[model samples]
Target: MYDVSPVQLLIIAAAGLITSVIGGVAGYGTGALMPLVLVPIVGAEPVVPIIALSAIFNNVSRATLFRDLVDWRRVRLVILPALPTCALGAWGYTLLDGRGALVVIGSMLVLSVPLRRTLKGRGVTLGNGALATSAAGWGVLVGGTSGAGIILISLLMAAGLEGAAVIATDAAVSTVMGVLKFGVFGVSGVITAQVVAVGLLMGVIAVPGAWLAKRLTERLPLRVHTAILDAVVITGGAAMLFRAATF
Candidate 1:
């Protein structure tokens, strides 16, 4: 169905599987990593749409698997304000050209590393009002980019969620937001047959990742995992920036 060679298809599947596992363990991975693989093959324009559709699959799996742990109140807080902003961001994304798309994606990925660290280190607590306001801003950021899930996860953590609750809540909120973003993309005329084909393929491959991540989360410390992931994200982001400059 794809013009991509079998090897590239295999690479996509492998990246999905690996990132799914990472996302499962860390509360975010597929968004950050998938863009690295997808941009090279599909170009930057389709990368977010591809991941946006696939995320409905990834987030739903986590939400379902961690259903009991979800804090629906937090989900509601994030969702209400994020919806409109998210739609706006997706529409803005549709306005970008290939190089602009690469720059946007790469800059977000790069900025996420330090932003995550700063948020975690401060361990800042957001009151409900602040949380809602923050979610409003976050909607615009995540709606347009692939790697900004870390912002949502950290936002949940600051609002008094930890461990499985954070993952579950993030997943639940993400699923809803994903649907909204997908609708925006569909109506904007960016949702192509290949986007559907690749998204579905990645989604199915990523579904089992949550269960596996559950097993690993209980046993692993995640410091190493986080460190390695940070390196990869930075490397990938830098590479994308380089390509953007050269392009």
Candidate 2:
């Protein structure tokens, strides 16, 4: 039971499925949205580790579905340079107390709105050297955070990937980083039987989400959905910061 009430477990499962569908349509959701539920139910420290494990399922599915579109060259460019700092960042996350964890996750969630917009609109292209260097910085941020995958998607696009290529590349990159995060948390002794159980349940429920999202993508005006989601994220993030300050 992972020490959770059945309702809490249900909430986690619902979050996984809802966020998965949101992610399938939007290219980023689980990382941004999952923390809103997980933080309250499990406390702040476990949020990143739980999401790190659950995300492996989400990203790996996207990678497989879009495997043909993945740019191996860009994957290589981003992954290698990112590994070291990713580890450093993951390790740093382990050191945060509950309040610190809440602030970090909340602040990132709040800023992700403008940061994602700015990166998406960033018309400047990157050369290989610059892309790799930028990825190193991305590694640090992503390693420690849940919602930073949007940054990776933007990076891929700015590096000349378009359409399916960007999604495919981001999924592949995130799969690897997700594994790296799990390993770092595992080594740091954050992994537990409860973590594995909850993460698996969430993943299994989410596995079919992309297919469901395909049906909704056409009817759902992405602009409207995105705007609404942005509002929710900002509100949820600010709430977390408030909780952190008062806790």
Candidate 3:
């Protein structure tokens, strides 16, 4: 029931386009940026809905662009754990205030980097139990923070997936995660007509941006692509911290 101005709608659309490109090229970071920027524009109540919708669009774009390279096995590993924990996190989010939720989410984002780096290339093959536990943890974290892609990206990289495969599988998993989060938000009364309308408008623009990113991805060197992703992760993590503190 929130009323968005024409200028605000345009801003949201532009943010969506930019976030899609970042998500498409980097495999993460879009969600981290969404709540940070949109919360102030639309207020905290609509932030999760906007983020969920944007995520749904982002994943759809990524899935469409990299359909051929998706790794089903990797996707399973992340989704298995993420689904349930995300639900729990979403439920918790509905009960908490924006600042409280942001604090929790922001801390997770900042902590995930060190966690990923320490765990990176360690050859720690996750069994069923480990996978489920990690997924639940990530889901809860992502449900609150909107950065579900972070854990999955790190796991995929550590699992030794190549460039296209990593992006494709991550996108596929994000699609599922986004759907779950959207449902949770909808049921919690967080998603409204205005939020959906603005989100869908943004989604329309995101498709092209994602496609452009995919084309760009093809031209970049592997190291350069990875560096870009790393930068996004670090920058996003920092942004989350700043937002949590200030807001």
Q: How close is candidate 2 to the true structure, as a TM-score?
A: 0.94
Residue 168 lDDT (model 3)? 90
lDDT of 1 at 15: 90
Residue pairs clashing in model 2 are: none
Q: Please, what is the whole-model Cα lDDT of each candidate in the order they appear?
A: 0.91, 0.85, 0.73
Better of 1 and 2 by TM-score: 1
TM-score for each of the candidates: 0.98, 0.94, 0.84
> Across residues 78-175, which tens digit of lDDT does each residue of candidate 3 receive?
78878888888887777867666666656655676667667765666665566656777778877766665767777776666767788898889878
Candidate order (TM-score): 1, 2, 3
Give per-candidate clash totals: 0, 0, 1
Residue 172, model 2, lDDT: 89
Clashes of 3: 1
Best by TM-score: 1
RMSD of 1: 1.3
Candidate RMSDs in order: 1.3, 1.7, 2.9
